[model samples]
Target: MFFAVALLLPAMAAADPLVGVWKTEPDRKNLISHIKITACGDKFCGKILSAYDATGKEVQTPNIGKKLFWDVSSEGSGKYGGGEFWVPLIDVDAVPQMTLQGDTLKVKGCEHVLCAHQTWSRLQS
Candidate 1:
C-alpha cells in the first residue's frame, strides 16, 4: 500500500501544471513572497512558503506558513476561480481569480468595488 501510494503521488502532482512554487511580484513595500500551490482534496490551494526583501534577502514573519488562498478549481483555458484570498494585515477576504500563462500566473483579488492584481512567476527548482 505504501509503495503504491508513493508511486502515485508524483504522478498525481505532475498531472496539474499549477502545482509548484511561484515567486510573487514585489508589493508596495518592496516585499516579495514565494507561494506554493498544491492540490487540496479535488481543488487547489496556496500558502506562503517564504518571503524576501527587495534585495533578495529572506525575511521571517508570523504569516510565513499561512494560507494565501483555497478552494480554487480550474475554469478551463488555464484560468481558475472560486476561491477566497486572506489578507492577514487587513483582516479581510477577497474573491480570487487566476490565469496561468506559461510560466506566469496572473492573480487577481476583489472585494466590492476594490480590486488588486499581481503577476507571479514560476519558481524553477
Candidate 2:
C-alpha cells in the first residue's frame, strides 16, 4: 500500500501544470524566494520553500513555509484566477490572477485599485 501511494503522489503532482517549485525574481533588496505550489483541497496553494539574501546565501525567515498563495482556481489553458495572495512585507492580502507560459509564471495581485506584478521562473527539480 505504501509503495502504491508513494508512486501515485508524483503522478498526481505532475498532472497539475502549476505543481512545482518556482523561483521568484530578486526583490529590491536582492532577496529571492522559492515557492512550492501544490493542491489545496479543490484549489491550489503555494508556500515558501526557501529564501536567499542579496549575497545569494540561504537564510531563515518567518515567512518560510507560510502560505503565500491560496484558493487559486484554474481558468483554463494556463490562466488562473480568484486567488488570495499574502504579502509578507506589509502582511496584507490581495486578489491575484496568474498565467503560466512555459517555465515562467506571471502574477498580478490587486488591493483595491493598487496592483503589483511578479514574474517567477520554474525551478528545475
Most TM-score-accurate candidate: 1
Candidate 1 C-alpha lDDT tens digits along 29-110: 7889999998885578899999999899999988799999998887878998988998655768999999999999999988
Looking at model 2, report the run of 10 residues with the lowest lDDT sum. 6-15
Local distance difference test, per candidate?
Answer: 0.87, 0.86
Residue pairs of candidate 1 with colliding backbone atoms: none
TM-score of each: 0.86, 0.85
Q: Model 1: residues >4 Å from true position, as ranges?
A: 1-14
Kindly report which residue pairs in candidate 2 clash with one another.
Answer: none
Deviation of model 2 at 37, angstroms: 0.2
lDDT of 1 at 88: 59
For candidate 2, report its TM-score. 0.85
**Clashing pairs counted in every model:** 0, 0
